[model samples]
Target: MAVLTVPITLVQAAKQGDKVAFMSLLEPSLEPGYRLACGMLHDSQAAEDAVQEAAFKAWRKLGQLREGHALRPWFLGIVANECRTVRRSRWWSVLKWPKSEHPVETSPDSGLSGIELRRALRRLDLNKRMVLVLHWYLDLPLDEISAITGISVHAVEGRLQRGMSELRRLMETRDEN
Candidate 1:
């Protein structure tokens, strides 16, 4: 596979213990990682924690990143794994995940749409949700999404179709109320 736009020089420098290079290399992925975690975990703090953990792990394993690999999807795969870990931890049941402190900026007419969309998205199963979020929200292609989720491209397409259907059904159900 072709390498993502992240410069090979940056990757090489990062591997040689260059903190600045590592930070620069990792910067592009931060928001996408946070967004993915937020959609998965539904709590800003947990999402932040997950992203932090993923970044740390990525830094530690910087040497393992293969040449010609797309860094964004690969790093997101790590973030997804971190989210799964957070979900499975013993204390997860006891912990109360907090709501997002930052208010979403939406036009008056469209504000309700944002809320409805989020609710509909929350209704999806993790597998379906990840596929949907990775594809639509992050603007990743089906093949890139498959790489991040460790699923086949066909499975990703199926999940995307199902997820969109479910989201539409959910939004329509809300409209009936």
Candidate 2:
């Protein structure tokens, strides 16, 4: 499959210290990066912070991006790494308060299934969760997910399959309750 990418000229210009060119290259990626961060971190504020930090790291490391590489996946890889870093920080666990015993009231318009799905997703280990989010939520192909996660395409497919199975089991178990 043909890989879509920004013009090489723009990347080159960005690498040459052109801030506008950098922003132009970076603009289209922000939303996806934010979404990826949110999926991994499961906190909007943390996600936003992760994305911002990823953007800065991406800018600093733009020169390291190989020619012909798509900026989105590379940027997203950085975002994923940033999310992992956020998750690994000592403050992350300390900051996570226990969930209240009270069940949240859902508005009719708010999809309960979505909420349940997110809860199940949060229960998944980070490896499976990352692949599930990158493939299913982000609609990224296995190869792209592989690139983003720095895993083999086969490994990504395995994780995707296992993640789907686990998610299904989680959903089914929830339904039984």
lDDT of each: 0.85, 0.88
RMSD of each: 2.5, 4.2
In the predicted model 2, the residue pairs found to clash are none
**Residue-level lDDT tens digits of model 2 in 1-177:** 434688899999999999999999999889889888878887777887899999999999999899888998899999999988988999999897454443333458759898998899999999899999988777888899988899999999999999999999999999999
In the range 1-177, model 1's lDDT, one tens digit per residue, is: 333667788889999999999998899899989888888877778888999999999999988888768788889999999998988899997977667676333458767788789878878887898888788777888888988998899999999999999999999899999
Deviation in Å, model 1, residue 92 alpha carbon: 2.7
TM-score of 1: 0.86
After superposing candidate 1 on the true structure, give the runs of residues whose Cα lies further than 4 Å from its correct spot: 1-3, 103-109
Locate the minimum summed-lDDT window of 10 residues in model 1: 98-107
What ranges in model 2 sit over 4 Å off? 96-110
**Best-matching candidate per lDDT:** 2
Q: What lDDT score is found at residue 3 in candidate 1? A: 30
Q: After superposition, how far is residue 49 of candidate 1 from its true place, in Å?
A: 1.0
